[model samples]
Target chain A: MRLKGFRLLTIITALVLSNNLLAQSIDDVLNRGQVHGNFGMDMQYYQVDSLIGASETPDEDVLMNGFANFIYTNGSFSAGFRYESYMNALQGFPAQYKGNGIGYRFASYTNDDMTVTVGNYYEQFGNGLIFRTYEALGGLGYDNSMDGMRINYKLRDGLFVKGIIGTQRLYFEQGDGVLRGVDGELMVNDFFGGSLKNSKTKLTLGASFISKYQADQSSQYNLPENVGAYSGRFLLRHRKISFNGEYAYKINDPSADNGFIYKEGTAFYAETAYSTKGFGLTLSAKGNDNMSFRSDRAAGQQDLLINYLPALTRQHTYNLLATLYPYATQPNGEMAFQGELVYKLKKKSFLGGKYGTGILVNYSTIYNIDSTAVPTAENDSTRMGYTTNIFSVGDERYYDEINVEITKKFSKKLKGIFTYSNMVFNQAVIQGKNPKKYPDVYADIAVIDLTYKINKKNAIRTEIQGLFTQQDQQEWATILIEYSFSPHWFVAIMDQYNYGNTNKDVDGNFNERIHYYFASAGYVRGANRFQVGYGRQRAGIFCIGGICRTVPAANGLTLSITSSF
Target chain B: MKKLILLSILTTLSFTIFSQQEKRAMPSVNVTDMEGGTVNTSEFNNDGKPMIVNFWATWCSPCKRELNNIADVYDDWVEETGVKLIAISIDDARNAGKVAPYVNGKGWEYEVYIDSNQDLKRALNVNNVPHTFLLNGKGEIVWQHNSYQEGDEDTLYEAVKALAAGKELKH
Candidate 1:
């Protein structure tokens, strides 16, 4: 690995020097070599549980993790590498990430009609039902860079094709399997020229096929010698409405999680939305079962997800109860539906008053499918692709939520929002394993947020939220305050209290109750910014940018600085 | 504790001073046009012309609507204010081939360019999609809006006419 790192660095150096010479030197350091990096250390000292689940707790320690990325881009040529080191890395971010090395290394070139990339790269097909790479940064950790090559070709008019071949990366090492795929897309109006261009209706068609080759291991018997999967999608847009959907099916493969036998799986997802002047609406549906299609079947969430299964439920970011019963996509036997509506009130209407108002309502539900109908006697020997009824629907519900929100601006600087939500979540799927035998039930939530500008230079924003439930823990409350001045700085303070807990300890104290408080401030000046915060944070499910991860509880201070030159 | 309070006061005072001095930072650019010729912003004037510069992506749905909505009124915009609109695409090579065709297919008369590397985006601080910036003939950025509403362009046009006629904007 060290030798490989040296080779990659040498190549980058050579590419930088050559590319710089090709371009006119702007200064002593050529403009061709544009370097940018992010360097920050999150040092957190943790106090162990000291009681239950305290088996692996270290006495007192400070954990630090940081990384720097540098890139040199000029014209059509670019190359970059990233260096990372985590001394006692964050609890949830993979422990094997402790070693210092070039986690990501890549080089690329592109022109008007063609582009090529060698080494590491990230790419995704439509909605990522077939393939997707790169991390979501704060939310998910599936950064599966290919250790090979990718090329894209632009054929006449609106036709484009992309092809890639390589072994997916698993942390610092390559996975045992090889992945190869190709995607082709067509913009309908582009092919027919002038007449089609004038048409109000537009259409786009895309297809992608990915195949994996993994050598058979002794632990699994009768594994498919070569596994292949194919997916296709189409998008249509006419005036104010649009629709898109993708479907995928995979050959049988055996893994420890599946009891060492092959079981074919399929997935389908589709969504349609319409919008005009002040209103927008969307409806979506998905069906997936035994289709947790990761590149390395044995690997968990550690850098091996090939395709992404978008959750059909809304992601909440509040502290306490917001995450208490979050819904995670169950890749085994589930069907789901989601709908949303948003409308903005007219300025002169009675409810709209002067500044106008906006209202939004959303609902989502997921249900389990009955699989007992499949004959158990033929499941072991038959090879007819795990017989599934072509258009059958399931009846058992796994999760559901309904949320409504109203926003009104009393004046230019004084605005407020009110929201109410009702939800039912299945802990059996969300938590992977049910700690409590009984599944979680429904809950009610409410939130009110208001902002007031005291003057031209000072402003304040506040939020009050509550969640009421009957299972596990009961009621929760949160209060937040923020003060800001334009173009420079802001500070925020928040606290959450779980005052209603059902369980009491031996001393008659609320064992389930927990209190958390945090204060943070940010300063922005030009391209450089700094933010720092400190407090006790209760562990919860965090979803940022559509990806979800569980964050562990901690008491610590954090400092972050980002700048570009 | 008194010292901490004093420090906080100083910080607030300094921030207020900074805010008072806040002036919009503008950049001078000579970007290459779709026809492969350089057009300097400082020299380009609307001259009573209502110009629309739209930043868009091939995958964003709202941007498509804004473009189509303008396309429906593009001829009128030209006849009314001699407006010249330009649509800049941020699609990389993976989807770059679709831009020109997509524009042509939509039959939009607006000028288009490919900012594949996003240099223009960084300069404009475009942190989100479907962002639009409206400039007056004096080449000064008179107004700007983030995201779009169905009839936002109408409001934008009214501002343009007022600015072109040397009248104060109603805001």
Candidate 2:
């Protein structure tokens, strides 16, 4: 195996050396370039509480997570780097993110129709089915920025091409696999601008090919050294109607996630939307079969993932609905479908008052892909572990949800939002829970959010939410109130109570009814903001495909500061 | 590695300290329009008038509120100060398709674009949604603010008016 050094994402750009710069003094030259960056820091102080299993806390007591980025851009050249430090990272973050250094940096130059970059960067191909790399939110502690060289150019008026040769970043180190990829796109209307450019119909076509190379060191099986994937996508639009779809396929490569199965992977997604003034309708579908593609086959759980598979579902923002039964996309194999309708009732009409009312109806579901195991008789002849019928949904259901929301302006100074959701969460399937330990959760959630304007700079907002379910923790109710002193300050308080507890503890006793409470205040001025809070519950965790981490019950004071310049 | 990083940092510092005075300009970055066409941030123009660049998303409640609130008086803002608002949605590909329809459903008469990969968001150093920046006629970012409350857009409008009147904004 070959070892490659130099893992940096910052751009060390080549400054301009034109004769025009020689005439200017140092101050003049330096003052021409602009510098911009942002800083964010999160620190939490913990208090031990034995009730919710927080009896012991870290010796550090106060854990901090922070980062700052500095970028300077002048004309066509830009260079920047990010500095990250996690003094014992915040709770529920990926364990790998210890003390961070420079996570991302890049230098790039764009001239004429071409641009070149060396160092760390993020890139994505059509729909990111074939290849994609990016950094998650700071608190997520997930980043897969690439360290390499990327060149993008406009081949013609409507034709564009890009190529990347790099390796994925894994924590502070680089992945074992080397990656190379190329992408090309064509705009039909722009390419042939005679009549097509002015026509109401618009069309775009694109294709991407990516391959990864890794050394074979396994003694158990002969692994493929080079694994490649390719995809094609197109978008068509005519007036108010738009349609787009992408299909990707990868060569057979045995990996740990698939039990070393030699089944080739295929995935495809398609969506169509029709929208007009005050009304929008959309439907989308996707099928994934062994679509998990990672730089290092040995890596596990979001490590070195080279592609993104979006779970076709509504990302609820409400507290109970978002945290409780959210469905994660099953990458290995799943068939998902979603449809939504967003419409606004006309003013002075039924259900609409002086101001119009906004209505949203959404339904989404996911099911396992149908697959049949290969006969043991011919298993070794061709090690294709199983065969799947494309888009064929299996009998087992993974997740299903239907929700509706109504936003209305009741009076001149009063507004309200009401939402209701009915979900059938396959806890045993989606969360990989034992059937005996947890049953399928059938839940109904309702939320009422209201805001009243007391004056120009003063307003009050309230939220009343309830979740009723027979499985997992029973029923819960919550209430929140916020006071806003506009242009500067805001204070809010919230309390969540587990009213109905039907589940038994490990000691065969009833679980404690913990009324998780929190209070916070914040001040914002210009581009800087300061927030201080006392909380007793952790935020929601993102569990992509049933892989979830337990968010410890927290009791602490939190301080967060953010600034941009 | 540490030495190399340190050296690179020094070079950038020197460039920034000497190159430009205190003028902050929008970085040139590419984002996709609703029509799948790539639009460069540097190409944003409003006929030599002040422009409001707002970074928002569909899932953010405060962002939705701010945009909706502005929509009610957008025509007045234009007539009074000729300020053009460009709402940039940072929705990833998963919800990119819903952006156009969602924007229309809400009846917001503002220029909208999708930063599907957050290229523009990162370039502008935006920490969270509702992060907004005001640019003068010359395209220099003059003032910026983040987060939103019920009446926050009023404060933003005041700055836009000041910028339109060629008044120095108190940052």
Candidate 3:
């Protein structure tokens, strides 16, 4: 293994240096490089609020999380590093991020069709069924960048290959297990270079093999030190229709996720879509069984996850519908599907008014995979916990939801969007809590959003949202209003109320029913932004740009600053 | 390791201050178009016209408002300035397929694409969604802005019109 890696390093070095040979001079190369970066800082001052359960105050009074990235690129050569500091990290951030350090650094160069990177990098292979690495940074504080060497090369005009050998990042350090993977993809039409080269129908096929190796240190049950997984994927597209699918299978090598069960795991995902000028539709399906893949077996609750299974439900943005009963993917076992349709009502039609109206309908459902216990004399001495069929869905449902939205432009200065959603959330399963203690939550949500353009340099937006349920915080409503002063400043205020909370407090008073109000203003100048807000926060998952994080309930003053150069 | 990175950054900063000549070109990062076709960022162009590159996502409210507002005046902007607007979705695979539907549902006419893994986003140093950039006719990045407030498109339009008039933006 050592010799092979050395040879790969030598070849990559040669390819990288080949481009430098053609440069005019070293000074010329140095002069052409560019420096760019981005910086972000989030700070909060906590205040004790007995009403919202924010009783504990930090000893320092202020907590902050900050990071800055610096990248320099010169033609085919580029390098970058990220500096992160958490002065006793925020309330919800990972506790391990307590100090300042260079969290990420990488050196990469590309020559011709070959690119090589050493140090750290983020990559995804074929839907990330078996391998993916990324940094969510501020929101989740989740980063799994591989800290090692990676090489990507194009064998031909249509064939590409990438190989990586590294260990996953665990907070401030690297995980103990080592991961190795190689992937190849080929464009069928382009590779053939014949009748299908320019055909409307296009096809791409890919395959990847990834393996993780960890030393066995457990004295109880013998665990497989090496676990390998493979995935096959294809993309087929035509004029108005497209389909993509991937199937992954992994060898039996469990440590803790599945009670150390030795059952082989499998997952399959498929997505198809059709779109036209003013209409679009999509359908997606996923099946997974005992696919709890993690670099460290003992790690739990969003740690050391090597593979990813995207959630099939709609990503709601409204405060009530988004944070109350949001859906999260179950990595252990699930059968899920989603379908969505979007259509625009033509202008001049009865429902369109002067401007066209937009309509969106979406549905999603998730259920546990059917599994039956293996009847063994020694109580499953084989350790093959259960038998499962990919096609069979069990009676226990995880989540189900359907929603419809209508958007229309009432006039030149006014527009409104109304949405209604019905969902059944099995918190017992989705939250991994005791089933007997918690019942499934049934909710109906509604939201109305409006925006009025006061002028070219100012505007106002408002959102009224409500969520009604019989269980888990009975009923809730939220109202938000924001005003903008064009290219410079804006202000906003919001209030979330739990109006129908029947649960009583210790003094037989309905103290649980409360109002959480927050207000803030922001300023933007060129590439810099600064905002200050004071509010009461609830305990739930908040997502920003696809990254989700669980924030603890708190009452505080928050400040954020961001800039790029 | 931290010291090494700091040293390298300092050295690069000095080099930049000492010799700054060439304009920064678009990074060659591969992202998928809305139609699932691979497109390299280096090839992004508008046939000698100014281009507006906007980064957005489905779940981001401000991003949606910005794009929807742009759609209202897109035809006028295009006919008057001959500018091309490119909207890039920074959504992950979870919502990749929903992009086209959402855009079409709103009847937006901008060129749409997907950066599922955020390769181009990272290369462009986009810290958050609603980050907008303007490129000249030669496809060289000239002006950039982060985040958005309603009516911010007017400022973006001013930049586009200036670029179309063959003027350099102070940004």
Off by over 4 Å in 2: A1-28, A375-382, A504-509, A541-554, B1-22
> Relative to the unseen true structure, what is the Cα RMSD of model 2?
8.8
**Candidate 2 structure quality by residue, lDDT tens digits, A50-87:** 75677767777998888999998877889999998889
Tell me which of candidates 1 and 2 scores higher on DockQ. 2
Clashing pairs in 1: A197-B105
Q: Model 3 segments beyond 4 Å from truth?
A: A1-27, A375-381, A539-554, B1-20
lDDT of 3 by residue, A1-565 (tens): 9999897778655544543343335448667788899998888899887777667677879999999999999988999999999997988678898899999999999998899999989998978888888888676788988999999887877788999999989889998889999999998887888888889999999999999988888776677889999999998989878898999999996756887888899999999988887798989999988888887776776777888888999988777887778898888799999999999898889987798888889999999999998755433436788899977999999999999999889988899999999999999988878889889999999999888889877788888989999888899998888888878888888899999999897899998898898787888887788877789866554422112233444468988788898
Q: Model 2, residue B5: what's the lDDT?
A: 52
| Candidate lDDT values, in order | 0.63, 0.83, 0.84
Model 3 — TM-score against the truth?
Answer: 0.92
TM-score on alpha carbons, each prediction: 0.73, 0.92, 0.92
Give i-RMS (Å) per prediction.
16.3, 8.6, 8.0
When summed lDDT is taken over every stretch of 10 residues in candidate 3 chain A, the lowest stretch is: A542-551
Better of 1 and 2 by TM-score: 2
Give the fraction of native contacts in model 1. 0.00
True contacts kept of 3: 0.52
Off by over 4 Å in 1: A1-33, A37-41, A48-60, A138-140, A320-322, A373-387, A539-553, B1-171
